[model samples]
Target: MVKFNVTRKETSPIDGQKPGTSGLRKKVKVFKQPNYLQNFVQSTFNALTPEKVKGATLVVSGDGRYYSKDAIQIIIKMAAANGVRRVWVGQHGLLSTPAVSAVIRERVGADGSKATGAFILTASHNPGGPHEDFGIKYNMENGGPAPEGITDKIFENTKTIKEYLVAEDLPDVDISTIGVTSFGGAEGQFDVDVFDSASDYVKLMKSIFDFESIKKLLSSPKFTFCYDALHGVAGAYAKRIFVEELGAPESSLLNCVPKEDFGGGHPDPNLTYAKELVARMGLGKTPSQDEPPEFGAAADGDADRNMVLGKRFFVTPSDSVAIIAANAVESIPYFSSGLKGVARFDIVLLRSMPTSAALDVVAKHLNLKFFEVPTGWKFFGNLMDAGLCSVCGEESFGTGSDHIREKDGIWAVLAWLSILAYKNKENLNGDQLVTVEDIVRKHWETYGRHYYTRYDYENVDAGAAKELMAHLVKLQSSIPDVNKLVKEIHSDVSNVASADEFEYKDPVDGSISKHQGIRYLFEDGSRLVS
Candidate 1:
C-alpha cells in the first residue's frame, strides 16, 4: 500500500542535541536545518523501544510559533512511518506546555483513545521567529516531562543516529481544520487527529476552580483584573476563559493575539521583558495615582510561566506559591477535600534554588511538608508524580501544583483571583477590596521577610566561574579564614556560621541529586555578601 518513496538517509551525529530538564531548544534557523529536527525526533523514538513506538498514540503540538506547523507535519509523517497508531495535534498546532500535559492525562477522544506521550514544541519564554528560538520536548503518559532516564537515552541516540523513518507518501494533513485524516501504509492505518486546543484544558481549570465565585469577583466594580499574554499562545485561552467564561471585559486583555514572532518583542514575563505590563501597572520610577487595574498578570511565550502584579507592586514567584497554597484551602474548590500530610495527600511544598525561605514559615504554619530541590521544575514534577508534592514553584516566575505536571500560567492567575474573591467577598458594595499588596504585606509581617535579592554575573568566563566556586569551596574548609577574608574585604562584614555544597534526596523516589549549589550561611541566617 505504501507507494511513495520513503528513504532512510544516512546522517552523521550532529552536536548539541542534548536536552535539558525540559527539552531541546535552539534558534529557529538551527531547527530549520535539513534533518536536524528529524534526527532528534527519530532519536526520541529510538530511545523508546519499538514496542513503545509502534501502535502508540502520540501528541505533537505546541505554541503557534514560526516552525510549529511544519514541525507538526514532519512529526506526524514520522509517527506513521514508525508504526505509531495515531497522532494528535492541537487545532492550528497550538497548545501550551501545561495544556499538553493536561491533554496527555485528561483528554479523551471520541473513539476512546488516549495519548501515550507528547512532543511539545516550545522554547518557553524565549523569543520566537526566523532568527529567534524554537524547541521540542517529550512528555510521558502521566502528564509530566520525561525524566532523566529517557532524556539521557535520547541524547545518546542523537550521538549515534544514522537514519530516521518517515512516511513520505502520506499527504500533509490540514492542521487548521478540526478533523481526522487517515492514511494507509505498510505500518498499518495511521490517523492524524486535530481537535480543539482549549476545551479539555478549560474543563480541567473549571474542575479545579469555582468559575461562578471567580466570575462574581470579576464582575464586582471594585475588583479590576488585567491579563497580558505577551502575544503568546496564552491569548487563545485567555479569551475563552477570562472573557467568555469569567465575564471579564474584552478591553482588559492585552496582547491577547497569538503572534509567531510575539510582535517582535520578548515573550518572557518579567519586569524587564514584560515592559508593557510593567508600565501599565504603574511601576514606573515616578509612581502616579493613575487608574491602574487592581490586579495584573502576564504569561510567557508558551503560557507555562506567569508574572503577577498589583497596582504598583510586584509579587515574587517565591512568595506567590506560598500565598497560593495558604489560600487554596479556602479559595480553590479542588482542595476542599483537602491537601494534608506530605506523603498521603501530596502536601509537600517543593522549592528550587532561588525560592524564598518564607515558604518554610508558611509550611510550618500550615503543617505542610517541604523540600528544597535544584533549579528545575522537573524535580518538582518527579515528587508530584510520586504523590509527594502538591504545590511548588520557582523564583523564575513558575508555579504549578499536582493538578498538572507543568507550571500553569493561567492556573496561577485563577488562584490569585480566587484568593482575592475569598478575602473580599463581603466588599461587593463598592467598598475597599483586599488587595494583592495587602495580602503580601500581611504574609510578610506574619512570617518575617527574608530580605532576599540576587545578582547575575553574566558574560563571565566559564573557567573563572569554576575557579571562583573552587575557591569558595576551599574557603569553606576554614570558617575563621573565610570570616577573616570577609572582614578584610569589608569592615562591616559579618562572620560565616557555615558554608557547604547543597545536596538533596527525593523523599518520594529516594533518588539523590548532588552538586545543587553552594550555600554560605552567615551568623544571622543570611548569606555572605559578594
Candidate 2:
C-alpha cells in the first residue's frame, strides 16, 4: 500500500518513562492510543547509541498474544531505522519468557555476528488480548532482562525523545517462513529472520537437564506423572519433550496446547487459577466435579510459572526450591559435578521474604549461604552474578538458578523428575518417597508452618491499597497493644521481631524500591502480612 519513514521528535511522554517489575504495563486501552507503542519503541531505539544498534542482531518474540504480531512488524521497521541489520524472530511470535532468555544468551553474542539480545513483547502471566494488557521489555546481551541501570537509561531517553524513525509502511513479511526478509526502501537490506522458536530453546533445555534420566523415569510403569501446559506456549515444548522425546504417555499432559486467549481462562499456575489440577489431585476418581482431571504439574502462561501436585498433595514453591537445592547434585546434571568445585560457600541461596524458611534450613544444613530478598525474581539476579548464590526462588510459583535469568517452570518440573528418579534408584517406594508435600510437611513439622494466607484485594483503588498498607504498617508498629490478643490465640507467641515496611535496594545498582510489601516476623517462626 503505502511506505513511509519516520523519526523521533522531542516529546514529553517520551522522556524518562520507567518500566515496572516486568515492563511498562497498564490497561490494554492505554496502549491502543495512536502512536503510543511507536513512541515507546522510538524512545527505546533512541536510548541506545548508534554503535549499539548498527549491525546488531536482535532476537524478537512475544507470548503469542493479541497485538503481538502487529508489534513485531513495528519493531522490525524501527530496528531497521535504528541501524539494526538482522533480527531473529520466533516462529508465530511465540516464545516463553525463559525461552527468550535462552535465545538471547545462546543466539546473541559479542562481535555482532550473532543476535546480541532481544525485545520481548509480553505482559507475562497478565491477561493478553486486544482488550488486555500488552508490554515490551529488552533483554541484554547476557540473556537477562535489562537491569535497572539500562532500563533507567531507556526511561530517561523516553522522556526526552524528540523523534523516532521508521520506514513508512513496509510490506509485511511472512513470519511463518524460516528465512530472512528485508524492510525499508532498500532491497536485500534491513533483514529479519523468522527462526524456529522451539529449536534453539529445546536445545538449551537438553543441555541443562538430564533428559535421559527423566526419560528413564517416565518409562517406568510403576511411576505416573502428568503435565498441564495451561494452554500457554509450553504446550509445544511439553508435548515434544514429555511425549515425543521422553515417550511419556500423551494422556499424561492436559491442556497441552497453546491458545491465544488461554482458552478464556486465567493461565496463572497458582492454587487460584489452576484449581482444576488441584481438584483432580485432591479427589481421585470422583466424576461429580467438573474439574479437569488431575495432573502432576501445571505451567502458567508463557510457561515460566509452575504448580506441582501429587494426588492430594501440594508443594509450596518455597519447599520446592529448598528440596531442589538440597538435591541439586543428584537431580540436576548442571550441578552434579560438585558445586563446591565451581563456586565457594559464597553460594547464597536466596528466597523472597514471604517464602517459608525451608531454604534457610537447607542452607544451614548444607553450610551454604542464604539470603531473604524482597519478592521478585529480579532481586536474585545480582546475587547470582556475584557468585554469592547459585539458586534462588520466591513464594510465588517461580524458581530458577543462574542458568538463564528467569524462573523456568519446565526446568523445575524436570528437576522434580530427576529427584524422583534418584529416589527410585535408591529403591524408595512411591509411598515412602519424599514428594513436595512431604518435604513441606517435614519442614513445617520442624519449623512450623507460617499459617500463611495472602489476601490479594485485586482491582482495589490504588489509593485504597496504599491506605490499607499504611494501616497495616501502623498496626505493626503498635503490636505491643495487640500482643495481648495475639497471645490469647497462641500463648507461645514470643518476641515480635521488628516490624516495618519492607524495602529493597538492588544489590547491583543500589536503586531502592520502597514499600515492596509489609512483613511481620515472630520469634516463634510465624510471619504475617506480606
- Which parts of model 2 are misplaced by more than 4 Å? 1-17, 108-112, 183-188, 283-295, 340-346, 426-451, 475-479, 482-495, 505-512
Q: lDDT (CA) for every model shown? A: 0.86, 0.74
Poorest 10 consecutive residues by lDDT, candidate 1: 338-347
Prediction 1 global C-alpha lDDT: 0.86
lDDT of 2 by residue, 1-530 (tens): 23335454334563224787676776567766666777787766666666668878888887776778888988888787677877788888888888888887776433346666788888777776667767788876767777666677778866766667776566676897877675554423577788777877778878878788778777765666778777888886888788887889998888877777777777888777776666666633444353332228988777878887765777778778887888787677888664766464656788888887778888888778777777666677766666666777877788888888778898888888887777666544344444555555765676445444555566779898778777778887677865766788888778676677888776756778777778777777667855
User: Per-residue CA lDDT of candidate 1, range 1-530, in tens?
Assistant: 33333557677789999998679999999998989999999999999877667898899999888999999989988888888988999999999999999999998877898888999999998889999899999998888888777899999999999899887777788999999887787656778899999999999999999899889999998888889999999998999999999999999999989999999998989888888788888986656566779999999999999999998899988888888977888888888676544433447777786676777778888777788888777788888777778888887789998999999999999999999988888886655888999999988888777666656675599899999988878888999988898889997876889988887777767777777778788886767433
lDDT of 2: 0.74
- The Cα error of candidate 2 at residue 128, in Å, is 2.6
Candidate 1 regions with alpha-carbon error over 4 angstroms: 1-6, 286-289, 340-346, 456-475, 528-530
TM-score of each: 0.94, 0.89
**Which candidate's TM-score is highest?**
1
